[model samples]
Target: MPAKSVANAKGHSAGFMNFIREQGVVGLAVGLAIGTAAGDTVKQLVGAFIDPLVQLIVGSQAGLKAAEFTLKVGDREGVFAWGAFVSSLITLLAVAFVVYAIVHLMKLDKLDKSKDK
Candidate 1:
């Protein structure tokens, strides 16, 4: 390639990097990755630790991941599958709690403490 072309390419790359940094794209990407991992961790924690405690109390299946309710009327049977919704709610709660704990520990909410006064 010509020297001018090489220099132009280098300039473009540097400009792109500068734009990314200035726009906080790198921080946003890192935050997204960490949020995904934290969600996975919360799922594992709920499944392995919290679910059993819940099961023991409710006398139901672990995490309520499974439940069946059947009704019979006029020779017809109706089935309701509430388990999936319950499990999803549990997961949401777990993720929220984990996020809250992380935020508390990191003191991210304290950034405005001085402003409040």
Candidate 2:
């Protein structure tokens, strides 16, 4: 390759790497991966432990996922599965809490650069 071509390639690579660093693309990707794993873990924790406790508190044999009521209107019945909604809500809350705890406990939030005024 010509010297000029080699210089241009080097410049392009440097620029690309600079863009990645300045935009925090790698950090964003890492955070996304960690968040996904944390969400899955939190869901399992909620399902295995918190869900059973909720079931005991609510007195539901099948747990929160089976806590639902049926609505009857003029021979028409509609099954409203509110228990599943509660289960999902609990999972969401648990995931958010876990993420918050991880970020704060590790002080990851402080790594972000302050924006220029």
Candidate 3:
């Protein structure tokens, strides 16, 4: 390889590293990964435990996820899956609560760099 090309590549590499550090890209990436895992965990918990309880209360023979209402109008039929929506909403709330709890308990919010005036 030419010396000039090698130097340019090194400069680009250094610039990229500096960008990552200055922008907190690594921390953002780690947070995203952990958040995804946490969301999945909460979904599983809701699906396995909370969903069944909801199903029992809703009295859906097909389970909460499959529970829906069918509306017939003339020759048209519309199915409204309210149960699925409720289940998803529950999952979202659970994930948000879990993330909030973790951040609060661990004081992770304090680690952020203060904004410049």
Q: Which structure among the candidates has the greatest lDDT?
A: 2
* Weakest 10 consecutive residues of candidate 3 by summed lDDT: 53-62
Per-residue lDDT tens digits of candidate 3, residues 1-117?
A: 999999999999999999999998998999999879977876687678765666677766356668799999999999999978876776577557766877799999888767893
CA lDDT, every model vs. true structure: 0.79, 0.81, 0.80
For model 1, residues 1-117, the per-residue Cα lDDT tens digits are 999999999999999999998988987898899879877887787789877766776667643656768899999999877886786676678668877887899997885465346
lDDT of 2 by residue, 3-81 (tens): 9999999999999999999998998999999879877887787678766766677767356688789999998999999
Evaluated at residue 21, the lDDT of candidate 1 is 86
Ranking by lDDT: 2, 3, 1
The candidate 1 region of ten consecutive residues with least summed lDDT is 108-117
What value of lDDT does candidate 1 attain over all alpha carbons?
0.79
